[model samples]
Target chain A: MRISWITEDKHTPSVVEYGKVSGEYSEKARGEHTSYQYFLYSSGKIHHVKIGPLHPATTYFYRCGRSGPEFSFKTPPSQFPLQFVVLGDLGQTEWTASTLKHVNSSDYDVFLLPGDLSYADTHQPLWDSFGRLVEPYASQRPWMVTEGNHEIESFPTSYPDSFIAFNARWPMPFQQSGSTSNLYYSFEVSGAHILMLGSYTDFHAQSDQYKWLQADLANVDRTTTPWLIALLHAPWYNTNTAHQGEGEAMRLAMEKLLYDARVDLVFAGHVHAYERFTRIYDNKADSCGPMYITIGDGGNREGLALTFQSPASPLSLYREPSFGHGRLRIENETHAQWSWHRNNDSDAFEADNVWIHSLRSSKECWNHTQDSSLDVHDEF
Target chain B: MRISWITEDKHTPSVVEYGKVSGEYSEKARGEHTSYQYFLYSSGKIHHVKIGPLHPATTYFYRCGRSGPEFSFKTPPSQFPLQFVVLGDLGQTEWTASTLKHVNSSDYDVFLLPGDLSYADTHQPLWDSFGRLVEPYASQRPWMVTEGNHEIESFPTSYPDSFIAFNARWPMPFQQSGSTSNLYYSFEVSGAHILMLGSYTDFHAQSDQYKWLQADLANVDRTTTPWLIALLHAPWYNTNTAHQGEGEAMRLAMEKLLYDARVDLVFAGHVHAYERFTRIYDNKADSCGPMYITIGDGGNREGLALTFQSPASPLSLYREPSFGHGRLRIENETHAQWSWHRNNDSDAFEADNVWIHSLRSSKECWNHTQDSSLDVHDEF
Candidate 1:
């Protein structure tokens, strides 16, 4: 259902026009206390009308004078450089606040939880706790999210429905996905194409997601949109022992497809650690492969994964299990800087940095000239 | 700053023993992956160990294995009940997917928002948009919020914060009163005491908030550990034309003596829409007022202040401007039936139909008859 707002003039007493189209009015009778009206349309559309202009930086929920069902929405000002703080594996624990504080300082457009949000078995109260913690931010900016392992605690029933609870409180683009599910979907932010993938679902070859992924990736044109980033629950080339091979399986299933399409970057969580890999392909370090980043340090109960297990091959670049969050600055299409913030048991601290240069020219690794096939020794 | 995650197992490889009597431990240089560690002492003091559990959920800016400085953290698990979902003035725009979908499915403990949630500003994303939108069952649970004039925009910054940019990414206790500020502070959930009052700061008077607010409220009985709650954007009892007696002209300046008490709920959102009052005293609503509900319909771009001008003495049994948000069940408080959910243009649906008997019996409004002084008159 669709909902809209209307305003009233001080000099004139008139019913605010909720919709420009005919036949858009509230179905529920109006009450003196009820200054607004709700309406439901024949097409299941909903609308809301107010007495006048509303306050800025506030949240609202309404239906158009009973013309349709009720819906909720928040209002934000028009501005640029909409800040979006992106991270994953943010368990509902005390540490989550630190990361939130840092992100909150910036004028971000949204808070993106790529996946692995709350830890496993987080019940309603836990969810409430998380809500309150992030309320300071979500109440202001849109708290956008994707599915993660922790969100899938209960199988079919609770897991899928849990998202419904999240959606009810916040609004998202669940309909964007071809499948009638919130699991996987796509949305646009200015000039960026954000593809949210679901790893818990069937991501194997011939799977619906595989086909969708291919189509979505192929549809992107470098002209209008030069940045293409994909978010999932697990990482493809993590070296942490806790979730070492967890995403390798999924990577094998979709890496080539993503690589062939030249996807720009990929973000994932799950392993309770932080890891960033150099661009690589098929178990080998290649400049063309998407840069893989794992930011699963969102504060949760489970401790961070600390051991790094180098692959039999030399694809792994760096790995750590410190609890923290990552920040990415998409400076144009060719230049991006990524940083990680660690929670040092006291207050949050800054820990790592990486400068990403697009591969528009040279196709070789500027930092490495060693045998590409040599096996790197396993080190923790 | 950039930070990386490192596990304890990678550093010490062996556990160290510390005397239980003393809260001190010997520190040794750790290996590559493990750098910092923590341990709890019998005296309740915490110390750092060569390889021990680091402070959980704190933010640390440290480097990994002699790398550069980066920021990172350990996120808490996505659990139920205590989790929170926060947002502000996030209209149902094209870029709202990430915030909506993410908060929807992920588990949260609680949902807390200061103000200006729905874009009641333009009425484009209405209440129905909120009701039918899915994030899992948060609709059926608790969704708590304060105020933003977007709930009542036409009135001016009559609401609070005058539509300043809200920070939804972080969760902080809105503490401090003598220091009046829009979107003010203080509150609590479970074991935590929170402070959330700040909307209209520049003014002062012998107002309710001014006559009773205090910092000692944080020193509650640890044995009982009843959470403290405090919130206000425009000081619900203010008196202004645009706001019309809203917030009662800064109550904090006069209410600094009530800090030594315990408060459970404190909520506020400008007249634009809705809010729930807490049961505390001073700016702290009492058990008599554990909850101070105010639905500001942040969604209303056009403000709605029909009641303020209405001869109705008591501000609102319930009022709507056309857009707003509500605070659902807080942590498992001992008292009060689950409060009702309030929105802008829709019939108040029982978002969660649970009875907060504990809260109800302990509060002042328990058996009090509905105040008839304020005539709620509207034609349906």
Candidate 2:
């Protein structure tokens, strides 16, 4: 696992000491630090330390640098019955705090954020503050995220490259999965193989992300990881008017690949609203296609996207504009429960619920042709 | 060493068979490939094969994709007395052919390009042509290059990220040196420690490139690699009015780091002209700084930058608007010879020559304080 923190002193050494018990750190690992730039702003040293080969599902207490308060975290389990908290657009706001509180209501193995974390925009210092804000919950569970349009803090002539601060601070395990960019990557946890795609980057047939996704999906053995899920920023299928057709280009470029892979679910966040669609592909319903869901209403400053298209499409099962989060509890290889809870005055209200079957376990979709041909049969 | 090539067949096994002698194949290695996109154009499968652990400075014959004409390349010598042919802005044209013919006239250990290789400029097919054009010389010698602005074929709303083709095609040994980005990296050749910096990317004090440079330079021991060299796209100091102040921001951001490291030479491209500066620092003549050189005049189609500023700066030693190339021959740890050859109709004429002393070998520069204080003395 990799641990990252910031210090005001650039000269201080980056050292992380950790063990299984509190107040007794047995192992020590040294890390590296770098600085970030914004107009007339100078950031402190951002340090990252990677210490692993650790036992899964075990608690580890760690301290950053030589002298500091110790923090503890539990690694994700390697067996079944793991849970994941899925949310996005989690900016630093009072509602964000409430959403986090609701998320803390239950135990999750990991947090999957499609995009738009912190909403730093271009103010680089917000990243440091956001780090402090999420340290409480994020220190306990792993947070795997991809980039969003907000992460592209590109300044015209000064900073041409996008995702400078985000990439430097929130680097994912991309190289481990043969990915060259931090914007996209994949990781296997418990019985699920999850792909975090990049909607803001190039996703054409020739793009690196597309090629990587193809190789990654082809290498996935459905027997080991039966549940295959994907996440990106913009929703490919949506009834919301805001940011309409934003992801159509990406969908046109890469929808068939996911459809052919028999992906069970595709979660996206960008419309600032919550909407769930039935298994769909190419703007139509298909059993082999993934369940498209937009869960961007995680208490961002942009407020809720209050409007939807008149006479919702048949593919959209449910749609709402509210601050909430979702949970995916994988009970076994073939069964899983998905629930969305909306933040209310005192507690979070369960707005929607569903039980899903892994696409690998479905006779109709599982036996689909490996080639480009996708003909859903009635043999289920 | 990583060898890269292009194949039309995506399913063709990315295999390389090699041996010490002609056609006596003894070892084979498998590689990987990916496709590229531009408009409606589709690219061939770009293949990369990494094969090493063999003896350096030895000739090895190899064939690509199981069936092809056998090709051979000589690994760079691990010892001193190595030669590097340096040029940049090499666009495909009749003049480019002449420059290659001139470069092929002598036996060089490796080819060093500052940037602007293909001038593809959004036309992805041109990259293949450029690769084919340089195969004869490039296949035999290792070509070490950084990115130029021309490599940024970013189509807004489609290809937002730059250097998709350049990075995928010509990947340097960046990860081995702890660099996270392919835009910048450092390597050691013979008695020289060379740094390939990205002029188009972020170079502020807090940028990743700046921080990586700090770590890389601090780890360099002058006792072993006495010659320190740096390469980028834009020339920091130039008398030509064409690209005046183009590299000023980068120079202001990173010049101090290189100066403090006692870099011996700084090579740059972008301005289509050839100019060499005396050992200077901060727009003034100072012996402690590197001898800045602009050798972008390697037959770019845009033509040469013919106009030079009136009342030439005293620091600029030689200035010309001609198609030419340069050769840096490192004879030993302390001494080296630099020569520039201009391509005439019949032959490449030797235009400029200079003998350089490695900064580490100079008594005045060798004992400079480790702090930021740089006070050159006349204690020679």
Candidate 3:
């Protein structure tokens, strides 16, 4: 986890504490001094300091690190409304620029970039350019990123170094996932539990990530969080001809675990298009199945994926060949709104919009548990 | 000028012709042309097409469109040794990675960058992280550049963008000069006579750039394939601190006659890095400057200067606090080298080792004329 702070002055003398009670940090730090760490900037005056990597679902108290006066904050509640902006394949293109502007204008507390950032390799200049472009928003909010195929340049060496550089620049809940690697991790945003899977890593049953995923899912207290979100780079249910069946192997490896766990949402990108799917279980529409959304429209030079596999595809709800981004807003325990905005050269008002409601909250939604004999291998 | 010709297929019949000679294009374009201006891809089968931008340089013809193969190219005796690389402020940093690696590995006939590169910004990232970096042996030849202040960001902008990026990138004809705009312009490499002057534009008259510099340096002899090189960023020799003395109020405002005369090799990048100085003259750096290099180190997080100014004191080389970049080599009458590498971070050896040299034959060094009577102002 990375944290940036803003302070009014460097010599303002303040102290920071974290514990069960907002004003009782010193008591909590009695034995485990490792609970807190402090640093000071030498020359330029610091106006603020942001700290993170806190344990998921745990409440903690924190305060400034000086005498005379101190600012305190309670960790975000374990159960509260959470908002995330999801996107992929975003580069320094006109469409990406528009999506960023729109997202920034809206109220997203955090951003999730599921692969294909800056695009095709980690060029320092390109990354710097990307940083400059995103600084307006990231400087104020958290921007978490995942690796895509394009980000892999040299293996075993440069690739890992680039990832290190990326992690240094952006903060994420990497430690919460129990995996030391940032390529895959999980975090809880208020009442919702989210798992970010790493498609770039080995996903075999014997791999540590798969085992960790299973352990994580099994330990989740569904009665408390009530919602589970899984995000990855490759779409397991995509009908786009470009990457047809490309992720089938991965699906065969882990889909059943996610299905049985009743995951609420699945987000993915890679086909260079925007696509959303209705609830599906075993190749058939089922209200109980997790909703899957593909937001690959984040501006890339590759244009968009315009074709769908077939009209009879039960999972396919909407697909557009244009470029844009996605926004997800959770209003309560069982209702949320999702929107997709397409960015054309025209004015800003011409955005395509959509809203997705939770299955528990929608009385008209269909249930699929009655069909126990459905074959999961059949393609719609 | 560094030019890359990319296509989707290598076997597809294609030709490039200029003057009276024509040849089949040998390289394949990477990805589908996403936009009319850019070709996208990371790696694959690759090939190249090259030529010089110098006068009497190899005149050639090329056919890219589907209009059939009837293109040709020819050049007068003056156009020998034709290709070059243009770069700037390529400090040895992560910011300079992609461009440095690519340009260093590519077969650019020659190279050149104006100024402010490999800035010894700080001790750690500078000497240890960037200084030792090297790009194969391509830089061992003839690299030329001006100096900028970031070369000594530890000092004030006294180093100026001119000397910083310039010194690191290229091997200019003059060094260790006492003139304030020593960051300023004008010179000759190969058959091309180039001009480069510092940006401190405000202090026009008493400003060394104004008094010692002469306009209408020469007229291009079409029969001899004459090519002229004129370079400067803060154009005027006098102005405020923003642009220093760009000479905009004096020399630049009166450069139309020189533009009509056809000069080349005008390169500059300050306003916070990265701009291909237009091939203009009077109002533009245009084809008159035909090929301008505004390779401000895009990697620099600091603001790339957008304005020009005159020197505050004689020791003033530049007035901003930032980093640096570099250029490569200049070859023949038509081709010159250019590139921009930043001083970020990388494990690679010799981060700050960037250079440009003529590919054909070496020339004798020129003599410097010192003026003892000139008034010298001190401002460290």
Candidate 4:
């Protein structure tokens, strides 16, 4: 097997020394970077390496280059009950420290961030700085992520095409899961299947992402991984007023596919608030509908969105405007717990908690009738 | 092409999004780390991705994961006259800061560090901290390195094998050059070829390294890269009382090959002081001898080696007891300038300067008679 790392200098060769332990190492991987920019990495090419035949649930020690302390990481177990931490719209702010501290102590096995990561907004230096900021936690866990509006940073004439920094650094496992677009992909952890969808990209019926999503959902083998959870940036059912109906069109376009595919949960952010809906299907509560949770308040510079739609809709169960994150504890194939926390300037407290249990068997869920035939209601 | 970064966490997938300026972006290489330790990357798999045929001398913007600011690095210019800063025995001391600052502002192309990086000895945690310490300059430039005593950290039965941290972190281009040992390797930059040797490894005639060195020197096509320089850990011709003859045996075993190959310069450390040697072979001055320089004064926790071999030899041109680093500015095919800076607290000043010029053509120099017939004098 081999190892890897990133160098500010694009020309710097990327190498990683890895083995079973700290000293007794075996292989080295020397990989190359895709591109570079002068704002930070004078030699801006991202260097990488390929290595493997690795065993799951193993611990190994390695470093990026000749320097750095002996960094160590543990591989995931090839089985189920993966503990994951979910976050979104995270920015570096005085409030972020608390959310991060809470996360560090939460005993998470993996991390899922649905975009708006550094919020560099085209400020290249911020992107570099953000890496070090999260290096403590991100470097330790398998932090899976998707793009958000903030990640669509672009500069006039200089970077007019957008997501330059976003797509350049966060290379997800999209290709391995059958999607060429960095916007969407699928992976498995224990018995749960996670689909990271793209809200910033084209979601219309004619788009490639839509077709990929259909195939990805169609390919899921629920018996092996009973849980089907989808994550994206914009919430399909947010009660907050900030981005009240910002994603309404996106929802209308893809909601039926996810609903028909028997997606058990949908996690999203971008409203700068925390909102949880009780299995909503077209603005109404339906047991078969996906449990929708919006956890956008990961302590960003843009204070929390405190305003909600006047006289909250019946579909809304709980909503909080504060800086914090969410956590998912998958206890088994059919039972999982999710909690939304609000950071009172770093003193985080759980604002809401729920046990989401799948009602039908893996095969039975996917075989259920579509929302177009069985679900239609204006209120819970 | 794609961009990437090293997260302390292995399970954390590697992702780099980059584009020309800030917005115009395209590719993404989502990779995962190979191995992780139970410590930092409890998810012990170093994440990595492969991207590129990046344009030379172009800058691109990227972020490691969804977080971090947009960091940019420039690809090296396709052609040379590359200026590289050289440093050795650098550790995490207050004095190291000054040395690094001086080297950073020196405006060099690549960084050459010949071991004793963190001075962590066996304290592994220091290795990780040192990465951040040198990240500012290292990430900006390709900091090339070799093994030193500090990196030879080994444990009892658990890690009876030494350099565990070294090999795991710094995977040199040894394999590329036909050297199976990470302790030795060779690479080319612009018009210069660098040979990084290991002082801690076995260098006897029958050793793999010796054979590799013989083959490497024999294969150098100096016509393309007219500059040939070798660097190692222990100094063979140091005037300092500290480690005065630490590498004497190594010199006796390998000096003839280097001298015969017309390796213009030999750099080393392990003597906590700086000393510049006039062209010497077997303790005697010779016009064709490689200019040997010992720059082990890059401050570490171990204070400077103030004592010297009293009544210094005539072959020694200059010597200084201080903490600092060096710089090499290759002007053309035959001439290059070298300078050493002392970190006077933070205000750095040049301690010595010299212009080293290779007198004969690459082939002509190598054709010179062996040192044994060149009238070796111990009492020179």
Q: Output the better candidate (3/4) by TM-score.
A: 4
Instruction: Between candidates 2 and 4, name the one with more favorable TM-score.
Output: 2
Instruction: Kindly list the per-residue Cα lDDT of model 3 for residues A330-352, writing each as its tens digit.
Output: 87778777777666633334344
Error of 1 at A288 (Å): 1.0
- Look at candidate 1 and tell me the lDDT of residue B377: 14
Give the candidates in order of DockQ, highest first. 3, 2, 1, 4
Q: Write the per-residue lDDT of candidate 4 for residues B89-181, one digit (tens) a residue.
A: 898888888788877765667778777898755445466678669767665556678988777654321234667666656566577788998
| Per-residue alpha-carbon lDDT of candidate 2 for residues B137-186, written as tens digits (9 for 90 to 100) | 88898899999877876644666778888988898989877789999999
Residue A333, model 4: Cα distance from true site in angstroms:
1.0
The 10 consecutive residues of candidate 3 chain A with the worst lDDT sum are A32-41
List, residue by residue over B218-323, the lDDT tens digit for candidate 3. 3223224345555554332222223333234444443543444444445555445443433444443232234434445434434344443333433222333233
DockQ of 1: 0.01
**Residue A133 lDDT in candidate 2:** 92
lDDT of each: 0.46, 0.85, 0.50, 0.73
Tell me the lDDT of candidate 4: 0.73
Model 2 C-alpha lDDT per residue in residues A1-380, reported as the tens digit of each score: 88888889777779999999998989999988888766445678888888877898999999998887889899988888999999999998898999999999877889999999987665565788899999999888889999877788765356667888888889888988889999999999878999999987888888898889888877777788889999999788878866666677899999988988889999999878889889997888988789888999899876788989999899999999999999889999988888888987344456888888888888888766344322222211
Cα distance off (Å), candidate 2, residue A365: 44
Each candidate structure's count of clashing pairs: 366, 0, 189, 80
Q: Which stretches of candidate 3 lie over 4 Å from their true place?
A: A1-160, A169-171, A189-191, A199-207, A233-260, A269-274, A280-289, A296-316, A319-336, A341-380, B1-67, B75-380
